[model samples]
Structure formats: C-alpha cells, structure tokens
Target: MSLTLPASRLRTQVASIIEGTGSSPAEARQVADNLVLANLSGHDSHGIGMVPRYVDAAAEGGLKPNSGVKVVLDTGALLTLDGQRGYGQIVGVQAMELGIARAKAHGSCIMTLGQAHHLGRIGHFAEMATAQGLVSMHFVNVLSRPVVAAWGGGDGRFGTNPCCIGIPLPGAEPFLLDFATSRVAQGKMRVAYNKGEKVAPGHLIDENGAPTDDPGVVVVPQSNGLFGALMTFGEHKGYGMAVACELLGGALTGGGTWHRPADTARTVLNGMLTVLIDPAKLGTQAAFETEARAFVDWLRQSPPGAGFDEVQIAGEPERKARAARERDGIWVDDATWSEIMAAGAKVGVRITSAD
Candidate 1:
C-alpha cells in the first residue's frame, strides 16, 4: 500500500524531522528539498526512504548538523574540500558552488570532496552545474560498506559507485545522465525489501554466488551470517567503471578506498571528484547550442525499436517524471512511510499526510 502527498507537504514534514535532529532550519530545508526532489524525479531509492538511516547516523555521531566544509587544497583550476562530517547535500552544494565559481573564471575546474555523509543524488550536483551554464561530470564512491561484487567474483567487493554528467543545452533543458555502476543500487534493494517486493532477475547473487531475484537475499543475513551481493551492470564494463570511480573519487579525494579492512563501527561517508567546464570558453555558445540541438533532433528522428514508443534522450525521462509527479502527488510506499514516521517520532517531529 502507498500514500500520496503533495511535494510541499512532504518537504515540510521532512524538514521538520531533520531540524529536530539539530540541523538549522536552512540546512534542514536543503536536505529535505534534495531528498524530495529525488522522489519527484522518480529516483525513490535515493529519496525519503533515507530518513531513518540519516536519523540513526545522526544519533551515532556519524552525521553532524550544520557542519561546515574545510578547504584542503586550492589551485586556480583545481581544488579539494573536506566535508568535516557535515551533511553531504550541504557540503556538496558548497563544493560545487566553488567549482562553478572557478569554472566561470578559468573556463574549467576540477574539484574533489572527501569525508562527506551520503551525497544524496549525484545528478543533483550535475544539475547545479548545468543551472550555472556549465558542463559537469561527477564520479562518486561510498566509503562505508561494500554491497557489490566484481564481474565474476562472488563476495561483496565494492560500493554502488555512481557517475553523472550534465550538459547545458542553452534553449532546452540540460542533458543529464546518471547511473549506478551496479545492476541495481543497494538502496533500491532496500526499497524493494521495504515494499515486500522482489527485484528483477540478474540484479543479485545469493550467498552461494547464484543469481537470485529476492531482494532480501542481499540485505538479510544468512545462516552463515553472510549477505548476498549485488551484481555489476553490463558485466565487466560496469565493473571497470566502478573500479575507476573508487580510485578517482576515493583515493584521489583522500578518502580511503573500499578495499580497506571492514570496520562495521565506522560511519558511512562519500567522496566525489567533479569536473566542470565552460563550453563558451572552448567555442561560441551559439555554435555549441546549435550543434547540440541539431544532433538531438536528428537522433530523435530515428524509428523506435521493438516495444518502444519513442527515442528518448538522457534527460527526457526525468523531465517527464518530474512533470507528472508535480501534477499528481508523490507516492510513498507503506513500509517507507512507517519508517519515516518512526524516525520523526525519534526526533519529536510528527509527520502527517495531507491527502
């Protein structure tokens, strides 16, 4: 079962709960808005379903409220930032703003961030860059847990490293692409478990290293005290990208790699390496926009393949989802709602639905 709530109501409730956890009103609003926007854009795995974990992390001293970022290195076109245990949504925006500023002045910037709490959605940072009229790409690695397996290996070896790229399209909406290297992100599996649903085949491998569609297999403990592992998307191809993300986002950003000894006592953290570019510096904005529009138009003209309705671009689906969700209230599954309510109660915030 699920309930529908207006985005504004949901945001207010989320913000209240986050604020109850010691975050300032502004920081709470930022975190709430980012999570709600993920749901609006059809990425529910990265949305409000995360509230419970965030709450627990705060209680455990893993996530700090209103923490500020620390600059580690500063060059004209390159920089590094330490999040100092702050909320990722806030720190990520700060780092990206710095990147955007440098890009505006130097025509390009490479920025890396380390020791940040879950950075919500990578696409959000890309969208920030696009909103600034800059092209951006981000590689992210989670440093807390390893839920994914290598191409042919059975045990868990890496996090669901994600990559995102956004290109400003001038007159049109920006072209944004974002995806997890795993066949499915761990959060998606958690969402499935919460909803009492199973995942698609080929998304998970059981403790015995056999393919399974049961989402619980990946999260629930087995008789031997081992959990299942998520598979890499596209076999070796996705595995390769995941490895690179770990190196660039983790090692390069000064956040240790996932290969470090498992320490269940440590808090979850994320590291990201972002590259921002000003197309105007390389070529005239007019020419770039013209060429981009032409290519997209030409590509869409191709006939759709079997079982397809139309040829869609990287950012089209998200735009459509946002429009529809804005019209209809966002949906919250029963289990996720229950968890949210409990999390709210812990923080002395009551979440009521306005349906």
Candidate 2:
C-alpha cells in the first residue's frame, strides 16, 4: 500500500527525522529537500527510502553528522578532498562549490572526493555545473555490499557504479545524462521489493547465477543466506565502465574498491571523480551554445517512433517529473513509511502516519 503526501509535508517529515540524527536544523532541511527532490525527479530509488539506512549508519557510528569536506590537495585546477563520512548532501555541495570556482578561474578543473556518505544523486552535482554554463562529468563508485555482478560472471562483486555527464544547452534545459552502469540501481530493486513487484528480465541474476525476475533476490537474503546480484546494463560495455569507475572513483580517489565479502556495515560510502569544463574560457562559448541548440532542435524534429511520443532530451524526463510531482503528491510505500517511523523513534522523534 502507498500513501500520497504533499511534497512540502514529506520534506518536513523527513527533515524532522534527519534532525533526530543529530544534524542541524539547516542541514536537516537541506538533506530532506535533496532526497525529496530526487523523488520529484522520478528517481524514487534515491529518495526518502534511504532514511532508515541513514539512521542505522549513524547509530553505528559510521556516518558522521555535521562534518564538512576537508581539502587534502588544491592546485588551482586539481583538487583532492575527503568527505569525512559526512552527509553527502552537505559535503557534495561543498566540493562542487569549490570545484566550480576553480573551473571558472582556470577554464577546467578535476576533483576527486572520497569517503562521502551516499552522495544521493550524482545528477544533482552535474546539474550544478550545467547551471553555471559549464560541462561536467562524474564517475562514482559505491563502497557497500557488492550488489552488481560483472558480465559473464556469477555472484556479487561490485556496486552499481554510476556515470554522469552534463552539457549546458544555453537557450534551453541542459542535457543531463546520469545512470548506473548496472541495468538499474540496487535501490530500485529495494523499491520493487517493497512494492511486492518484479523487475523486468535481464536486470538480475539469482545467487546461483541463474536468471530471475524477483527483485527480492537482491533485496533480502535467500534461503541459503546468499544474495543475488544486479546485471550490468550494456553487457561487456557497462562492465568495462563499472571497472573504470572503480579504478578512477575508487582507486585513484583513494577510496579503495570492494573486494572482501559483503559486511554488515550500514554505512555506504562513495568515491567520486569529477571533471568540469568552462566553454567560455575555452574560447568556444558562442559556437558551443549555437551548435548545442541546433543539435537539440534537430533531434526534436525527429518524428515520434513506436510507443514514444517525441524525441526527448536526457534531462527532459526529470524536469517533467518535477513539474508534475510538484502539483500532485509524492507516494510513499507503507513498508518504507513504517521503517522511517521506526527510524524516527530511535532518536526520540515521534512520527505519526499521515501526520
């Protein structure tokens, strides 16, 4: 079962829970709004369902509250920072603010951030760069249970590593392409399991490496006490990309890759490699904007194909979702809501259903 709550109310409720986790009022609201925005953008996988995990991670002393990013190295266009396990919503912004300024000053900047506590949505950071008329790319790796299996391989080995790119389309919405290298995010499977639904084929494999449509294969331990794994999106191509992310975002960034058996640690960490480019500083501002606009228009001119209404850009769906969800309400599953309520109780905060 699901209940629809107004976005504002949901944000407030989530903020209250965050505050219970020892976050400041301002940090609580910021984190709450960021999670809610993910829901509004149609990516419920990265939304409020994560609150329960956050609470667990915090109580386990793995997630640090109110911590900030610490710069380890800064050389004009290159940066290395440590997140100190802080809330990703906070440290991610700090890293971007620093990287954005450097990009603007030097025409380009490369930054690596390690040890962030679940940097919610990578697209959020890309959007920040595109908003500033800069191009940005992010490669991020997850340091949690290895939930994604490699192509032609069996069992879990790595996370659903994600890659994102943002290109500013001067006169219109920017092209924001963000996706997990896996066929779908592990969190999406969590959502499906909560809803008692099955995912499409080709997205998952059972613990024995056999195929299965049940999202629970990855959500919960099976009878054998083993967990299934998500499959890579483009087979070998995606597997290769996931490896690259683990190398750059994990190894190069000093966050390290997942190698040992999945532990019971509630903390989920991320290592990110971000590159920002300023077109104006590259002496291609005018041509870049014009060409981008022309290409987008040309793409839109393509007639609707098959079940598609029209050609949509990468960022179009998220923007459309935001507009519609803002009018309607966000839906929270009964099970997820219950877990959230329990999380609130842990920190002495009371949450009433529908309150």
Candidate No. with top TM-score:
2
Q: Pick the candidate with the highest lDDT.
A: 2
Q: How high is the lDDT of residue 162 in model 1?
A: 96
lDDT of 1 by residue, 1-355 (tens): 8899888998899999999889999999999999999999989989988898889889989999999888999997999899988999999999998999999999999999999999988999999999989999999999876889998898788899999999998678889999999988888898899889888888999888988888987766777777788998999999999999999999999976887544453356899999999988877788889999999889889999999999988888888988999889899989889999999999998776742
* True-structure RMSD for candidate 1: 1.6
* Model 2: per-residue Cα lDDT over 1-355, one tens digit each: 7888888988999999999999999999999999999999999999999999999999998899999999999999999999999999999999999999999999999999999999998999999999999999999999999999988899989999899999999878899999999999999999999999988989999988999999999989999999999999899999999999999999999988889999878899999999999999999889998888998999999999999999998989999999999899888898888888999999888877667
What candidate 2 gets wrong by more than 4 Å, as runs, is: none
Local distance difference test, candidate 1: 0.89
Candidate 2: what lDDT?
0.94
Q: How close is candidate 2 to the true structure, as a TM-score?
A: 0.99
Residue pairs that clash (backbone atoms under 3 angstroms), model 2 = none
Q: What would the TM-score be for candidate 1 when compared with the true structure?
A: 0.96
